[model samples]
Target: MENDQQQKLISELVFLIEKGNAHVSMEDAVAGLPANMRTVIPENLPYSIWQLIEHIRIAQKDILDFCVSEDHEKLAWPDDYWTEPVEHIDDQTWENALNEIKQERQRFFDLLQDEKTDLFSPIEWGDGQTILCEAMLIADHNAYHTAEIVVIRRMLGCWR
Candidate 1:
């Protein structure tokens, strides 16, 4: 559990991005709330609102795994198959989605002390010199779509 500056930066980046995701998670986790309002999409798209979450979640997991194991092939996603799909999920699907996202986010942060690797390994599709770069990328990815969902929710009168 070393508290180095680099680890702090990674943790902070993860926190910032996840905070953005959490802002919309309340509305995003609303099951079948509305196709546009809900974060998880129920169809085949590069990233549905939920898909974005899943994509971000899996991306973080995959990247961390890739960095530690050098199993970058584990990062190989199918053609046009980036986000994990969840169509016609049950009534409580929203809860599951929320839990999954939160768990993955926490798990990514938990690696701070245990995994001593430099956080700068380039993740798939990452432009930065380290995982911290992609950390922001994932956060920005969620932020972008979460904003989209927020707009949709507003249009649906679900805005606070």
Candidate 2:
């Protein structure tokens, strides 16, 4: 990535953040979720709703970083560093952190959409693939967890 592209992406991220594009899905997914249940974890379930949000946000951050970085940490075979580790998080802290992450995430996604960078360009974090190649990789992760959050709300009897 050239310094110019990085500069544009950085500015675009700020524009996206100013536009308030994040939280659209999160708000809708948790729309009817009981405020109380936002902190609850189901039996044997290691991931909470807030944890999932944090995880996805981490992926977004790393992906965005790789888009501009010259050196990104290489991941072992079949082990993507883009994914976040899930663990119990304090309810209050999770909620606060999640909101902040959402704000940043919107910027990251918008940066990607606006970059329109070369599909053949190598991803700094990946083995040896273009940024486009890596982007397609994250699409499923976001979609899958978006569905998971939707279902979680339903399971909690909070989905309307």
Candidate 3:
């Protein structure tokens, strides 16, 4: 791809991941959540806001790792990706988790920004996935979970 085309593609991916043009951004979905409610699972819901938050962090990190690392081991389904609700989360820990998500997201953005990273080339490892595929996967996965957080908040009467 030409330099201009690559830069444009990277710009679009960044916006898709960060701007929440089609749904609530992860940050906005969790912002101002009551600490008391973070671990409260709504009726019929399998996970809490806290679990969803952590799941997003874990899954995003996994995909980012896959995109960049040839040695990345595949994570087990359900077990590796999902988390049980905790009894409580301190403010600092919660903030740290959120910051980890932010930092990992920035790392992915940096990968895209690098001129040498080929967005369309297939991975040489187990799959034929390309950086473009991985980028869209991250965006889609985060958006889906972020929407779930919003729905759970609304169910708990906590959403504004």
List clashing residue pairs in candidate 3: none
Full candidate order by lDDT, most accurate first? 3, 2, 1
Candidate 2 per-residue C-alpha lDDT over 25-116 given as tens digits, one digit per residue, 9 for 90 to 100: 55566555555675566666655676567666767566666776767554453345223344445557766766766665665556556646
Model 1, runs deviating above 4 Å: 1-4, 21-48, 72-87, 121-129
Which candidate leads the pack in lDDT?
A: 3
Tens-digit lDDT track of model 3 for 1-160: 7888889889999999987687878889988999999999999989999999899999999999888887887899989999877889999989998999999999999998987888888977736898889889989998999999999999999999
Candidate 2 segments exceeding 4 Å error: 1-24, 71-98, 113-116
lDDT values of the candidates? 0.55, 0.59, 0.90
- Give the clash total for candidate 2: 0
Cα displacement (angstroms), candidate 3, residue 141, comes to 0.2
The digit string of per-residue lDDT tens for model 1 on 16-125 reads 76665356543343444554344444243344455554555566566556544544555455543264455644536656666776776666566643565456555444
My TM-score estimates for the predictions, one after another, are: 0.60, 0.61, 0.96
